[model samples]
Target: MAATACGTGSGPGGRADGRTERVTSLTALDYYTDTTEHAHWGELLTGCGEKAGVAVEHRSVPAPSLVPTALRQASAGTLPDLLMLDNPDLQQFARSGVLAPLRAYGVRTDGFGAGILSAGTYRGEVYGLAPTVNTLALFYDKRALAEAGVPVPRTWDELRKAARATTRPGRYGLAVDADASFEATFQFLPFLWSNGGDERRLDDPRAVEALGLWTGLVRDGSVSRSVLTWNQADVHEQFLGGRAAMMVNGPWRIPALDAAEDLDWGVVPLPVPRAGDALVTPLGGEVWTVPRNDSEARRRKAAEVLACLNGPASMLALADWHHTVPSRPDVAGRY
Candidate 1:
């Protein structure tokens, strides 16, 4: 699929139920509190609104508060016209009946990655669609790694060796966010999943091996002890401040990485358990969903806005602005 292959309108608009009245504005909700993302998303949404011929009123909350805030809205029967849910929480909202399945509203989903589809699914129904998605990669400071004669690490042993060999008086060779939060699990997934560890079988030997590998890096002083207090953004800071030769981060940090005029960085797939194994990192992004609305006309209008938002041009625009991949595989090639 390609950008040109994306949809152009709400397919076969039979639901213009003649009662659309005069909705001057519709509300939208998301967790993009960062200024860049907030402004960019507002621009994108406003553009989509214009294309759909509706005035879009945007609202946002911190990511941690989204679900609770949504629940409050749900209780008040006042969910936004268009709601953006982080992929993981899509199932929760769908299961709770706050989210209406997109298929019923004619949103496209046939060309997205399976991981993305899985995240937005609830009991076999697609409840949301993200225009773009992101995942972790091993980001190395090119100059630092080259100076230390460390080529990009490709496997567990190689990464360990490179990390240890590159550590110096003030810098650790590698950095990771080992904070005791969901981010820790997200950051650890590549190691565990790349090693064929199963999420369902947490005590499996493969899981233990991955955990042991991380512990080994810490023991050898190749990974900083401060990792316990860090998050993904913190890892980016370590890489930017020259405190770490390499770190695992997502493409969303590309803008931040581009800020330091002297920072020379390169990215590669996260290292695996063995030379031939594929890296398996967690897929991440927010999905757009139409909340259960009071009227058919409102739902139809919201779906039209959604149709525009997920179209190729919008997806590509968003992906480029944020340094993320378009959710539509066809459109993603443009990135």
Candidate 2:
């Protein structure tokens, strides 16, 4: 099994004075440039920081700028006391030894979903955990599909058929990001994983089949060629403008979707390759980490804030605020 490690220790954080250091403030870094997202995080960080007996100096950057910022911080030996990395980048950061292994700080990882754990693990140890995680889903205009007498699709065949039936004079039936970027890969993974396409074997016929499914949608005019240039935000805009009836997106778009002009949207699991096949979508979220610091007490205090931020109630609150599912399945029930 490709499982993330969950063990306990209290060894690493920072090397501080032998005496416990008093931390007045801790630096926190995240990529939550969206006004609502940034504010929500600020409120949560304040509450958690208070509980940890430290004030938080929170800073946010655009999502695209986060990795570069972290890289610069790492090189300068000035990584924030706390870091929030999109899951894919967590392991690499952890592997570089700049991140303090979360378990060492008495943080629990007992009930996070496998995918989230997988993304935050390096070698056999977990270095981070998210408060809320998201995954791709099939989002349809409920009214449009209902008006067209089409139900939600459950398999590749049904998805193709629904897309075909919904295609109209000014609108495409479906849309996705087909650009050559990680966003495209993110949007493609559900189809690939659902069809049993292993990332380790790109030569596998299942992988080709999954690719064919997406290309076939475009070839058949069910999807626009614009997908080649569009990203998820573009796709979301298209869906909101009624230029696409269905999209492969996630709940992170829900806040915007809710604010749109009277669009009734419904979400379902991404379509499977075949009926009865389990839907397997890529996990999307940011994981919190405590960086290696010079002060052990400060590092430990930062870990306290990290833990406080991910407590059950905090998880639910953030998940609700972000329109995402809580990282811990047990805590998700309350949201």
lDDT of each: 0.82, 0.84
Model 1 agreement with the true structure over 55-158: per-residue lDDT tens digits: 77787787668888998998899998889987877877898898888888777778887877788889999888888888888998888878888678998888
In the predicted model 2, the residue pairs found to clash are: none
- TM-score against truth, every candidate: 0.87, 0.86
- After superposition, the stretches of candidate 1 with alpha carbons farther than 4 Å from their true spots are 1-20, 110-115
Best by lDDT: 2
The 10-residue segment with the lowest total lDDT in model 2:
1-10
Task: List candidate 2 segments past 4 Å from native.
Answer: 1-21, 110-115
Instruction: Give lDDT tens digits, candidate 2, residues 1-335.
Output: 01111212223333334554456678889987777777788888888877766678888886668889999999999999999998888877887899998888788888887877777788988888888887888899988788778789989999999999899989999999998767788999888988999878878999999999999999999999999999888899999999999998878788889898789998988899999998888878888999996777777888888898878988888777768888877788777
Clashes of 1: 1
For model 1, where is the 10-residue window of minimal lDDT? 1-10
Candidate 1 vs. true structure, TM-score: 0.87
RMSD of each: 5.2, 6.2
Query: What is the RMSD, in Å, between candidate 1 and the native fold over all Cα?
Result: 5.2
